[model samples]
Target: MRSTFDFSPLFRSSVGFDRMLNALEAANRMAPAENWPPYDIVKSGEDDYRIVMAVAGFSEKELTITHEQNMLIVTSEKADEDEKQYLHRGIPSQAFERRFELADYVKVTAAKLVDGLLTIDLKREIPEEMKPHRIEITDETAPRQGNMHQIEAEAAA
Candidate 1:
């Protein structure tokens, strides 16, 4: 049985969460995930992440990685099949495409194929102006004569 959820109430009360809600709906509507090419996502550091995909029969030349506006697209071009008839073929050489959604300020730094494994490294670099910073708080009650509160008190007198 397929399950569906309504997010109308959330939309009525929330702000700035449209993208997240759309992602959830899109994921629910997508087809069954393809498990042919196994992959792993690892969090290596506080702001660093790694994605490793197993592509046994694919070469570096046949694989492509693209970063387009918060989306990572990995595609494997279909190679010509040989005429050799195999009694039992197990390895997969079929063309496949995989996509990954990246958070804001997250970017792919490097990708390398080693020993039939494709590794992609990503890092999140928040802008200096956007990062959280310490804000100094001062005593409001005990203020200088030029302070707004003091001015207001004198004006009322």
Candidate 2:
């Protein structure tokens, strides 16, 4: 059985989180999850991450990785198979597409296919202006030189 959730209450209290909420809702509505092409996501460093997927029968040419804004899309379409009789087919060669929603400033750094494993590296590069910085607190009673002109103008009035 499938389950559903309501986010109306969250929308009423939260601001600037529409994208995150929508992503969550879309995830919930997605078709029953498929286990094909098993994958793993690992945090290698404080701001670095890696996504490793098992693409047994796929080659570099058959796989594609794309980043659009905050969405990362990975797709694979196997080439036409040759007419060869197979006693048993265990590995699947069907085309598949996978998507991941990245947080702000998260970017794909590199991708490599080694020994049937596709490893994609990601790094979160926050702009210097957006980084948090400490602000020095000053006494309220202290005279401020920066606003002396404004104070003088008001006094003159």
The model with the greatest TM-score is: 2
lDDT of model 2 at position 139 = 88
> What lDDT does each candidate get?
0.90, 0.92
Query: What is the lDDT, from 0 to 100, of the residue 64 in candidate 2?
Result: 94
Model 2 residue 85 distance off true place after TM-score fit, in angstroms: 1.5
Candidate RMSDs in order = 5.5, 5.0
Clashing pairs in 2: none
Task: Write candidate 1's Cα lDDT for 1-157 as tens digits.
Answer: 8898888888889999988888888988998889968999999999999999999988899999999988999999977877998899888888999999988899999999999999999999999999999998877777566754523445564
57, model 1: CA deviation in Å? 1.0
Worst 10 residues of 1 by lDDT: 148-157
Q: Which window of ten consecutive residues has the lowest lDDT sum in model 2?
A: 148-157
Report the Cα lDDT for candidate 1.
0.90
| Best candidate, lDDT | 2
Kindly report which residue stretches of model 2 are placed more than 4 angstroms away from their true locations once superposed: 136-141, 146-157
